[model samples]
Target: MIQDKFKRWIAGAAAVSCFMGAISAGAAASSNKLPFNDIAGSFAKDAIVRLYNKEILSGTTESTFSPKKSVTRAEFVIILDRVLGIEPVHSAINPFKDVSEKAWYYDAVTAAVQVGLADGTGAHTFEPAKAVTRQEAAVLLVRALNQTGINGSTSAYVDEEEIASWADSAVGAVRTLGLMSGDENDQFRPSDGMSRQEMAAVIDRVLQNVKWAAALNKQSNATRIQMGWQYGQTTAQFEQSVFQAKVTTLSPRWFFFDPNGVVADNADQSLVTWASKNKRQIWAMVGNRSNQEVTHQNLSNVTYRGKVVSQLTSYVQKYGLKGLNIDFENLAPADRASMTAFITELSTQLHKIGAVVSVCVSPDLGSDWTDGFDYQALGAVADYIVMMAYDEHWSTSPKAGSVSSMPYVNNAVTTLLKVVSAKKVILALPYYNRDWTIAKDGSVIASELTLVEQDSLVRKRALRPTWDAAVQQYTVSYQLNTLKHQIWVEDGRSLAAKYKTVMDHNLAGLAYWYMGGASPDIYTSLSNAERFYGLSFD
Candidate 1:
C-alpha cells in the first residue's frame, strides 16, 4: 500500500498538478513557482512578491528579481547552495582559462565541480560566464540530488526519451520532493534554456523540498554523516524501527519507534540520541507486511501507508542510527513482482541520502516462499541480507526438533548465498521455544511462548522436560491433572549450539531473537560467540 502510493506520487499525479497550461507559446506556467511568479516583463513582479512572501529566492536588487535577464551559472549554483541547501563537496578550484581567482562565479562553479554538478571539456576550462541551457540545468539539478536514477546512465544524452528513461529515477526523485515538474502535455523541455524566471521558480520549489529533506537528513547525519542517509526512506526501515529491540523467536508481528511496545513522539530525536550514546546501527523496515492483508481496500489505505512511511523515515533520521533493514514478510503468492517493484523503488529513495538497505529473508527454496522474500531481486539492491533462520519446528508439528538446527541453519545459509553475497547475510538466531497441549486430536495450534515462561508453567504444573537427542529438543508429554502437555525450550546449550552452527557456516554475524527478554547474559553470550570466532559486527 505504501509502495503503491509512492509509485503514484512519482508516476504523474504530482507532475500533472504542478505543470499547468502554457500561458502562451513561450510562456508556459512554471509549476516550480508559487503564485508570486518567476518570468520577467510580466511574471517577475508577482514572482518576486511570492518569493518575498515565502522568503526563498531573493533578488540582485532591493525590489527586482530581474526575471527577464538570463541567470548566470554562478548565480544558479549560489541559489541552489545557499537557499536550497544543495550541498557541494569543496574541491580545489582550477578550471576555465578565462575564469580567474577574482571572478564572481568562481566559488560557486568550483563547488559545483566538487559535487559533480558540471564537468568542463578536456580543455580544462569552466566557462563560468556561459549561460546554463535548459537541458544542462536539468542535468545539474538532478546531479545535485546524486540520483543515478533507474537506468543507471550518465546525466548527459543526445535524445530526450532515452534521458527520461534513464532519468525516470531522477525525474521521479525530484518530483517526489516537489522540486521540478513537466508540461501539461507531458513534455519536459530538457534542452531548452533556463530563463531567469524559470531558474528562480525552480529554485523556490527545490528550496521548499530541501528544507524538509534537510531536517530529515540532519537527524541521519547525527548518527554517521560519513556513511550517508536519506529521506522518503523505506518500508523495511519502518518495520525494524517499529519492532526495534523487541524482536523474538516467534515474531509474527513487529512495532516501530516504540521502545518497549509504545509509540514514540519525535522518534528521530529520541533514536538519534540513543544510537549516538549506545554506538548502535539503526535499521529501517521496508516493504508491506500488511498492504495486501486486508479484505477490502480504498485510496485511504494508500495514504495512511504513505503517512507511515514518511513518518518512519523522519523518525529514523532524527536519531543518530545505522541504516535500514527491510522485512516486508508474509506476502501473498501473486504479488511477487509488486514486491520486487517496491524494493526497487524503495532502494532508490533510501540510497539518495546515503543510507544502506539490508533486507531480511526466510529461506527461499525457489518454491512455496512468499512474495516478500524475493532473494534474487532483493539481493540486487539491498546492502546485505538477514537470513531469519528460526521456526523450523512448531508446537503443532507431529514430531519435535530444534527450531533452528545445524542442518536448518546450514541449508538456509547455503541457499541464500546462491542468491546474495555472503558478506551481506546476518544469520538471525532463535532464543525462545514452543509449548503445546496434546490430546486425542493428534496436534493443536502452536503456543508461541518464551523459554522462561515455559519453565514457569512447567514448574507450576509439576511437568518435567524430557531430552530428545534425535532432533536436539526437549519434549515433556506428561499428564497435567488428567490432561497432557508438551513443551520445547531452547536453553543456553541449544543457543550455544546454534551459535556454533553460525560459525561453521561462516555467516556474516549472529543476530539474536527477542532482545527485550533481558536474559542475564543472552546478548553477552552472542557477543562472545562472535568474538570467539573472530567475527565482528562492527
Candidate 2:
C-alpha cells in the first residue's frame, strides 16, 4: 500500500511539470506575436510598441506589460536617461541616503542628479520605490529638455491652486508644449501617481515634438502666406490700415458672378498697383453672392461654366493678378459634384497662367451648407483651401451663444485635416462678435459687433465680462428693461488661443475674415504668436 501511494505521487508531479512548461511556451509564442498581452486595448499601446521597437522600453514579463502599474521614481529616471543617452556616472559618495553603491539604479540616479534632471526628496533621501507624481514628472521632463525660464498661463486649469509653487512653471511649460494635458474636467491632478502607460505617452509626445521642431527649423526659409480678405475698404483706406504691413496676400472683392453667368468688373487698378508696390500678392476674390440657384444654373451648364472660367482667367491676365480666391457659399447638397468640377476647371486654367487658386469652404458640420464641399477633391486641385471656421451660431439661430467657440473651431480643424493636407489649408478667423438679445417672449435677435465696438460697449455699459474656460472666451450678460442681453467678446486673449491651433498643426497660415473690422490688439496678438513660433508675417 505504501509503494502504491508513492507511484501515485510521482504521476501527479509529472502532470504538474508538464502544465508549467506549456504555460512558458505559450507566453513565448504570444510575445513573438504582439508587444504585450495586456496592452491590446490600452490607450498607450502605440507609444509602448514604438518605444519597445526602439529598445527604449521593456515589459515586466515576456508576454504581459504592466501598463497600469505605478512607475517608481528610480525607474522613470532610468528611462529618461536612456532616451537622452546620458551615460551613467559613478561616484564614491552617494547623494541620497536611500541609494547605495551596490544598487542597480545608483549610477543612473547619480547621472540624473549631476545633469540636473532630478533631485532628492528631502533630507538627502531619494524615495526610489515611491511612485512619481504628475507634478514631479513634469518638473523632471522640463529639466530633461533643458528649457529654462519657460512660463505659460495655468488659468485654463480649474485646479491651478493645487499645483505646488516649485512646479508651477514646469507644469505650465509642459502644458503649452503639448507634452501633457488636463483631465476631462480640465483639472491637472498634480499629486496623483503617474502610471507606466502615462509615462510612455508623455515620452512619445516629447520625441514627436522634438522631431517637429527640427523640421520647422529646416523649413524656416519657406515663406508661409498670411492673407486677409478686404471688403468695404478702398485702396487709400487699405494703405492707411495696420493690416497692410502684416499680410502677404490681399484678397479684395473684385469680381462677382451674376445669375446670367456674367462676370462683374469691380476690380480696382489702384489697389492692384498699391499691393504690388507693397510687395503683396493680389488674390482677387470671385464670389457667387450666396445665390444658390444662380450658382447651380451656371456650374451645371458646360458652356456657361467654361465662359466663367475664361472670364476669370482673362481678369487674372488683365490685372496681372497673382492669385484668385473662390468664395462660393450657400449651395445645395446635390451641387457637390458640379462645384468640384467648376473648381477643377478654374484651377487648371489658372495654373496655366501661373496664378494660384484658393477656394474658401465652410466647416463640414453635416449640414447642407457644408455638404456641398468635397474637401478631398477640392484640395487636390486648388493651390490652397481656406477654411471659414466661423458661424457656429449664425444670425438666424434660435439660440444665443458664442459664434465660433474654442471647442467648435478646434473640432472643425481636426475634422478638416483628415481630408486635406495641412500644408494646403489656411484657417480663417473672425474679427467680429455677436450681441444677442432675448425678449420676454423668448425670441432671440443677434447683431454683429466688431472687436473695437464690442470693447467700447462693454466699457460704456459698466458690464463686467467673465472668462469662460470651457469656451476659451469672455462673456457678458445683463438684464435691462425686461430683456436679457448676452455678448461673447473676441479680444486679444481669445485670438491668441485660436492662433495656438495654427502653430500646433503646422498649418499654412492665417486669414482674417475682413480687415476693416480688425482692431490693433488683434494685430499685436498675431505678431506675438508669429515671434513665438519663429514665423514671419509671410
Candidate 3:
C-alpha cells in the first residue's frame, strides 16, 4: 500500500498539509518546522502555491484559500474525504442502528461502520452532522490510519499536560500518523479542535496515508477499489475530497435508486457485475422507506426478479453485492417516524439476506424533514447516515444563499448530531451548482446545472454572469425584456475546494448530487485517498 512506503511515523512530522505541494511523494517531508510561509509578499504566494499544487488546502476561491479561518466539522470531512477517495470503498462492515435507508450518507456510513472509520459514540446513531472536538478528531484520525493497514497503536493520553489523559492515544495517533506534532512546546492539546491551518496540515499528512494505501491497491492490477458516498457540512473544499475518494475507492457511485421490486439497468448491471466480482459495494437503494409505506410504488417493474427484496437477495447470492443505499425522496411528513421504522424493517430483511442498509439525508436535520426521518431511530436501524448538505440555496427559494455554506452546514450538523451519532455520519457535498433567476417582482427560481453548461450560457449571451457573494457563486443578471434571472454554476476549482470540507471534521465519507457531472479531471482528485484510510465499500 502507499502507506507502507513511508516510515509509519515521521520524526519531525511538520504540519504536512499546511504547506501546499508538500504532499507529493519522494520530496522529503521534514518535521518540527514552521509548516507555512508567512512571508508578506512573493514568499507567501509561493508558499500558498506549493500547498495548492500538492492538493493540500486551497482556499475558497481561485485566488485565496483563507489559511487562517477555523476548520469546522464539515470542513474537516472534506479533507478526509479527499484522502479516502483514493482508497477502496469497503464492503458494508460495521452496523449502526440510527443510519437508515433515508439517511444521506447511508452508503458511506455503512461502509465506515463496517471498517471502523466511524465508531458509535453511545447509541447506534451515527451523528452525520456535528462539530468535531480536537480529541474526537484525533481519535478518528488515529483510527483512520489503523484502517489503512497501519498496525501501530499510538501512545495513550497520559495527561500530556495539554489534554486530559483519556485522549492521549488519540493525540499520539494523530502525531504518529504524521498528521501533526504539536507546537515546538512538545504539548499535544488533545481537547482543542484543530485550526484551519492545523487541519490543512493534518489533512495533508493523512493524504500521505492515502497515497500509501493507493500504492498498495495498485500493486495488483486485478484488485480494483470500490467507490460509494460521503456527506459533509459544507460544499467548498469537500468537493475535491469526494473526487479524491472516488479515485481511492476506485469505484463508481451506484445510481442509488428507490425502486421497490427490482432495478436492473444495463448500466447498473454492468457496474454491479464488476462490483460483485471485485467484491465492491455499490449503492443498493431501497424502494420502501423507513416508513415502509412503499417509497416507490413502481419498483416492482424495476426489480431484479420482480421484487426489490428478491433482486437484492439475488444480487447478494450471485453478484456479491456489498451494501444498499436508500434514496427515497419526497415522502409525506406524517411518515417521518415511519421512515425510521421502514429502514429498521429493511435492515432486518437485508441483514437476514446478508446486505448492509444506508440512507440519504438532507443537510437539514430530522426536524427539517419530519415525513421519513427519525435519525436516531434510523441510525439505530441501519449502518450509517449520509448527511446530504446541499440545496442550501434552492433554485426555487425566496432568498439566495450558498448552496452549502460552512456556517449553515455547521448549524445543520450541530442539530443533526443532537438527534443522531457522529461516528456513523457521512457528510455529503453537491457535485453540481444551483443557478437562480430573480424577477422584477422579487420572485426567484433556480435550477441545478453543471459548470461547463452554466458557463456556456454566459459565453453564448443566453445569460449574463454576475458574482453572488452571499452564496459564493457567479450569478448572471439579465432582464429577459422584463424578467430578471440568475444562476449559480460550480467550477472545477470551486468544487475541489468544497469537497475537502468532508475530511476536515472526520466524517466517514461524502456523496455527490448525481453521477453525470463527474468527468475524468474531477475524478482524479480521489487518486490519493487509499493511503489514509480503508473505504467501507458497502
Candidate 4:
C-alpha cells in the first residue's frame, strides 16, 4: 500500500519537474505565459521553479523532469555541498570503500562526512546509490543548517512512534522550523524516500531561513574589522593588552560635542603613533555626550553640521587618521532626518579624503531611544554601522540583571541585519559586567565591574557561578551586609557564545566596549573563534 502511494506521488512530482524545467529554460530566453505548465497547480510549483531558476537543482532533461525519481544519498549530499560551499578534503585514501576518488560525487561525499553532515552506512562503506530516507534527510538537513541539538517536539505528528531515537530531535527541529512537514495524513513517513520535488522544497525553505542566499549573491564585501574601543587608558596600558595583536582598528574616545555645538578636541597623538607603529587603523570616536538638546541644535543647523563635518575631515587629514566613529546618543526622535543628513555630509567629506566613517547605533527595540537612527540611511552613507549591543541593565535601573544577555544581543543583531548589510555591521561586545545590590527597601544599586574586577570579586568572595543557559552567561547571587547581590559574569564561555553569533551570521566583525577591561583569556577565546570561522584580523 505504501509503495503504491509513493509511486503515485513520484509520478506527479516528475510531471511537475518536467513542467518546471521547460518553463525555466524558456524563462532564460524570454517571458512566457505560465512559465510552468503542467505543475502550475502543484503545491511544489513555486519551490521547484525558484530552485530551478537559481540552478540549485535541475530537471532530468531539458524537456522532461524525472521528479518522481528518488534522490540518492550521494545526490542529496552534492546538493547540500553546493548550497553550503563545503570545501572538500583532498585525500588519497577514501574513507568509504564504495565511494571512489574518481567518481563525480566523491568530493561531495567526502566534504559531507568531513563536516559531520553524513556518515557511511557501515564500516568503511557508504551505500551512495541507496535512496535517502525522509528521516535521514531531516537529520542531514538540520546539520546542513548548522542547527543541530535544537530541541523540538515531534508529538504533533501522527507517526511519532516510528521516528528513530537518533533522528527524533532532528525531525522535530526541522518540523518546528517549518523546513519540512508530514504528508496529507499528517504522518511523517520516516522510512519513505524523498522525491526530487520534495528535496527542492526543503532546500528552498532552508535558503529562506538562513543567510546562504545573501552570502552567495555577494551583497557585502566589507573586510571584517576587529576593533577595540579605548577610553581613559594610557599608551602603556593599551600596549600591555593581549587583544591588541588581533585587533584591526582602535576607536579611542577623543572627540566630543558640547552644548554650544563646539567640538572638543581630545585627540591623542601618542595613541595614533602607537596604532600606526602596530599597523592598526585608528577610527577616533566622536561623541555627542548623550545631550539631546545639544545633538538637536548641532545637527538641525546646516552651518553647525558642516562645521562639525569640516573639523572631523580636517582632523582625519591632519592626524593621518583612518576614520571617525560617530557615537551620538540620546537624540530627539524628531532629529532623525537631520541626523541622517549630518552623517551623509560627514561621510561624503570623509570619503573624499580617503577616510571612512562608522556610526554607532543602539538596538532598535521599537522604542523612542532608537527612533533617531535611520539604520538603512545610515548604512548607506557610513562605511560601517557599529551596534552598541549592551547595557540591557542600566547603571541606575530599578531591577538587577545582566548588562547584556544572550537573547538581547541576538535579537539586536537580528534586528540590525534586517536594515543593514551583514558585511557592514560590527557587533560591539561588552568587557564589563554589572553587579546589582538589592537593599531591604527594594532599591537597586548597580556598579559596573570590569573583567578584572569581576574576577577579583568572584575569587575574593569565594563565589562559584553556574551557567545560565537562558542568558548564555554565568550567574551567582550572594548576600553581603544585609544587601542581596547578583552578578551575571562575562567570561570566556559567555564571550565565546557571542563570537559564534558573529561568525554564524557572517557579520563584518566584532569590537570590544573598551580595551582596558579585557583579560588575556578573552583574546584567546576570540582568536580561537576567528580561526574556527576562518576569519582574519587583517
RMSD of each: 25.7, 21.7, 15.9, 16.1
How well does each candidate superpose onto the true structure, as a TM-score? 0.45, 0.62, 0.48, 0.60
Whose TM-score is higher: candidate 2's or candidate 4's?
2
Candidate 2 lDDT over residue span 1-538, tens digit each:
2223223323332233221011134563574456678887789988988876555566666566788988889888877766655445443324355887566677667666543467789735889889999989999987776555677877899999999999899999889878887999999999998898999999888766756335323333436678888866777776556243378888888898887667888989988888888788999999988999898988888888888999999999999999999998887888899989999999999999999999998888888888888999999999999988888898999998888888988998898899899999899988888999998888899999877688777767766555576997768887878789998777655676787788789889888887867666467455534433443212
Which of candidates 2 and 4 reaches a greater lDDT?
2
**Clash totals for all candidate models:** 36, 1, 147, 0
Which residue runs does candidate 1 get wrong by more than 4 Å? 1-268, 286-315, 365-372, 394-402, 458-470, 531-538
TM-score ranking of the models: 2, 4, 3, 1
* Backbone steric clashes in candidate 4, count: 0
lDDT of 4 by residue, 1-538 (tens): 2223223323333343332233245644332343333445556777877766565665665533455678888878867765655433332224466876666566557556543467778646788888989999999977766567567888988999999998899999888778888889889998899887788788888767545455433322346788888865786787556234477888888888875557889887887788788788999999988989888988998888888888888889989999999998798899999999999999999889899999998889888988998999999888899998899988988888988898999999999898899999999999888889999988899998898788778767766565576997778788989789999888765776787788889898888888878666567555434433442211
Q: Which stretches of candidate 4 lie over 4 Å from their true place?
A: 1-223, 242-245, 533-538
Which lDDT value does model 4 have at 236?
A: 74
User: Any idea how many clashes model 2 has?
Assistant: 1
Candidate 3 residue-wise lDDT at 424 = 68
Minimum summed lDDT over a 10-residue window in model 1 is located at 220-229
lDDT comparing candidate 4 with the true structure: 0.75
